[model samples]
Target: MDLYIFCRMVLQQKALILLVTVVVAALASAYAFLVRPEYQVSSVLRPAAINELDALNRSEIYQLPSGDALIKVGASLESYETRLGFFRANQKLFKNFERPGRTLEQSFEEFNYNSIKLVVPDAKNAGSLNAYIKLVMNYPEGVAGVAILNGFVQYAIESQRQQIAADMEVIVRNRLSELAGRLDSARSSYVTDKAAKIAKLTEEDNLKRAQLQDELKALRAQLKNQRADQIAQLNEAIGIAKSLGIQKPSTPSSLGGAGVQGSQPVMRTEVNNQQIPLYFMGVDALLAERAALLQRKSDDFTEARIAQIAKELQLLQANREVEVLNQRKNEDLFLSGVQPLRAEEVRLRNLNVDMSGLKLVTIDKKAIDPLGPVKPKKMLLIIIGIVFGLMLGLVAAFVRGTDQSRRENSSDTTLLPHSSIPAKKALLSNVEAL
Candidate 1:
């Protein structure tokens, strides 16, 4: 293993080494020319950054911008699923193209391991949120190789755009669906509450109307009795005047309760702790006139007093009905503001329109056919072969020399049979002389 001894052995076997080196050189030349070479084409792409997606995400569904999402998209372009999709989509193209085997699956696998490659830059090291994607493809030397990369460029760009757009739309729809459900619940609650309040108001108004009607009938009866009593009083006064032949009664007669009724006070209602008063001035005036007419006994006075009493009762009944309706009107709140929520529903529905047509990625550079083949390094291979061949030659020489020395030491005769004994001895003598 020492340098001097090894050098001596190699020099002694220089002829064998030269032959092996020449043979290796010829083989390497053949390989360089005969083996098929591969041509590579590459395309650069710019993926949508998280910020870019966020800008397009009007629904605010995505949590944040993610460089990793872009990176994954790039990586998926090289995946089996995506490649299979390309193959299936371009079945006509694949049918006409050269394949390694009969099945499309075989051809697809060949393209997967050997032809297609992805070079996605690490976003973490790039000091940028978005990293660019590069795709490299190596194909067997032919025009088809160029076409393959060209087609792939389109497939990748289109697929990535579609993928990103679809993802965004899905997220938007999910967010919209949640919002829609919540809005529906709120609307339902509003509608139910409005209906309940309206029903309660109607019932309360009905009760108030019934109570007012009962009170009006009672007032009518009281007024009828008063009218009958007043008519009798007027008749009695007339009888006294006729019998005594006097123009006026000698005794000043009490007008019963007509004076008390003349001071007509309006009723006041209590609403939410506030008192609201309703006045009946017409009833007060009519009662005062009736009382003055009742003091006389003439025919005209009797007729006028009865007419005034009837008019006062009618006005009182009408005023009571108005008070009942006014109370119902004052307690309305729910139905007055019911349109705003409905308008919001309309707005949200319109906000959920189509957003599927957005573009998420753009192609920066397309794949182009390389001017020359990318593989088969002729000079480098030739150098390696020459070195390997010389080592083989040296090893062969050492083995042959060792076999010869063993034969000479172990055998009493020459290494050849007895017929070559003289020649073998002559060869040994020549070596000794040298």
Candidate 2:
């Protein structure tokens, strides 16, 4: 175990050490040159600007903030489903992962799980205002990493935009349908109210007409009775005038009782009164009044109130309120609440949020061609190979040295008993040759 002796022993096996080092170094170099290297390609994404989302935010129906858009894009980037979909769509870009035993599905799974990565700010710096997402892909040779990154980003954004559009469409349709339903309900209510008003007017008119007719009949009956009484009183006066032999309408003072057969002499006196009695009027005038009263057809014309009641009944035959309601050209004008709802519906229907060029997230940095592969550091590998070869060569040299020393000792021990000077000299010579 002396350092000088071990050095000599190692030098004795210098050819073996040289052969082992050269072989190991050559194998490392071959492997380094032959294995495919993976290159790193990445893109950075940031939240969109306010101006970019202005069109979508202008309407009250829906609102989307820039931060939310960034979150959605980031989530899409991190989704396994999204990566798998991208892999399936761009299989040609990932054909290099395919091998004899691996099916396309397995290769895609490997690529999706291992190759693609989303780099986000750590929890400590996650809440920073400058939050971003970095999409990284380590691709093998023959694959277009930059193209895949760019295409996947575009695809994700487009997918999110389409989803937003579809959601807006559903919202508009539902709102419009709800508005339409309200309009229908309002129309029905308006119609029902109108019909009820008409019915009410009709009932009032009928009742008024019936009351007017009853009043007219009562007035006519009263007038007819008065006429009959007047005629009966006139006949009685005529009889009395015949008995007294009065032949003309005359004042009571003008009447003289110059009758024969036990009649007393009459005394005349003047009396002033506004009305004269029917009996006091002469037989000829009374008879004429009675004849006229008996020949009368209707008593309605005699009373002024009867004429007024008839006119009212004629007017009530047609309800002017009902006529106006039925003749209305624009019934919607009356529904004050409905018009505002209609206006709102029209505004909503006219709303247009154009998302043709909608950009959800800003691409701070797009993927570009890498200058070189990130893995398989050639110089590092060569250095490691050289170190490993030197260590193995030392181990082999130590083993050979130990075995040669043990054999020299054993041969000396076994040959010493019968050894001559010549044998001893020969053994010494053999040891020197070794």
Candidate 3:
């Protein structure tokens, strides 16, 4: 009830309190010194750019590169199978460092699945590569813990490297093959287009040349007509000279001069009266005939005029021939179609064959030994044990005190029956207070 009374009661049961305190203290000390200490060795391993164009290399046309791949690496390192296999692979080391009361396989399994922890640090920034992979290994031995964590990290990195390389090689090879196929097919089509264009242009040229030939023939016929006229005029002039009793001219050889049109007039009589006038036809017949003679004229062009016409005709024929030749040459130069474009497309496709790259990349942080054990804080446990021992000892003392008080009251009731009521009431109050 009061401090002094409680102290007096505890003093009466000092032996029991002291025994409980000693037992609790001894148990605490045993636990502090005997249990094996546990250490937590932690390390970080984040994915780093493996190449200069790591982002470009890993990216595809429509896909986002996954930082989750790095997370997978971290997770695989803490898997039960991986840890168990690692322990089994190094049996002697595992036996030496593994925790007690479990087989090596079981011990490593628990260590990986239960004790080891994974953390994605800075997870709020998961949209990018802001997250870091944190791996923690909890074990009884600090050096072994660090070694095991490092080993797992190496395995994970290698696995990621292999996976990335294989995948990228497949993609690149497929893309390269596709490019080659397209370029080859395009080039073949280009060749075919070129041949077709050449054929078309040649056909058009041949047709044009044929038309030119026809034009030349017609122009030549026009030139021939002019020549024939010139020849005929030369013959007519020679015949006229012969009729005048002049010596025959030398045989005509060239038709270089112009053409002449000749019109001859014949004699005709016009009767004026029934009697012929003596003055008109009498012995002065010569004079009368002269008066009656009709003026005979020929309708003929001058040589100069014929020559001018011939030259103009010749000029027109030459101009037509020249124009036809020019048209054929111009139309045959190039095809206005798909061949040129196909050739250019082939060139562009060929240019894409040169770009290539490597695929997998990795970087890691090494695991380091922990500064001290993580568990079994000896100084802290000793302090806790002191407080625990005091409380337990006080509880034992109170229980002993209550039992002793009840025994004393029972003995008083038996020895003095008349004062039992008052004594029992006082006893009840004392028990209540206790």
lDDT of each: 0.61, 0.83, 0.58
Query: lDDT per residue, candidate 2, 1-434, as tens digits?
Result: 36888799789988878878887887888888889988999999998889998878887777889988988888888777777787788888777878889887898888887787888887686764758989999988888889988999988888788778888888888989998999888888999999998998898888889888898888888998988887788889889877866677777656543333465665667777767666677778778887888898888778999989978988987788888999999887787487778888898888774566889999999999999998788888888888888778888987898788868765775767554767777776665555
How many clashes show up per model? 0, 1, 0
Q: Write the per-residue lDDT of candidate 3 for residues 284-362, one digit (tens) a residue.
A: 3333333333221221232344445455445444344334434554332333443554555454344322223322224
User: Against the correct fold, how does model 1 do in TM-score?
Assistant: 0.60
Model 2 lDDT, full chain set: 0.83
Put down candidate 1 lDDT per residue, 77-166, tens digits, no spaces. Answer: 776787888877776655534464568777777667877788876746874544677888877664465566668666754675566656
Name every residue pair that clashes in candidate 1. Answer: none
Top model number, TM-score: 2
Cα displacement (Å) at residue 59, model 1: 6.8
1 or 2, which is superior by TM-score? 2
User: How do the predictions measure up, each by TM-score?
Assistant: 0.60, 0.85, 0.55
Model 1 misplaced regions, further than 4 Å = 1-13, 47-69, 91-102, 122-124, 167-201, 227-248, 251-359, 362-365, 371-374, 404-434
Off by over 4 Å in 3: 45-109, 120-133, 141-143, 205-365, 417-428, 431-434
Looking at model 2, the pairs that clash are 249-282
Per-residue lDDT of 246 in model 3 = 30
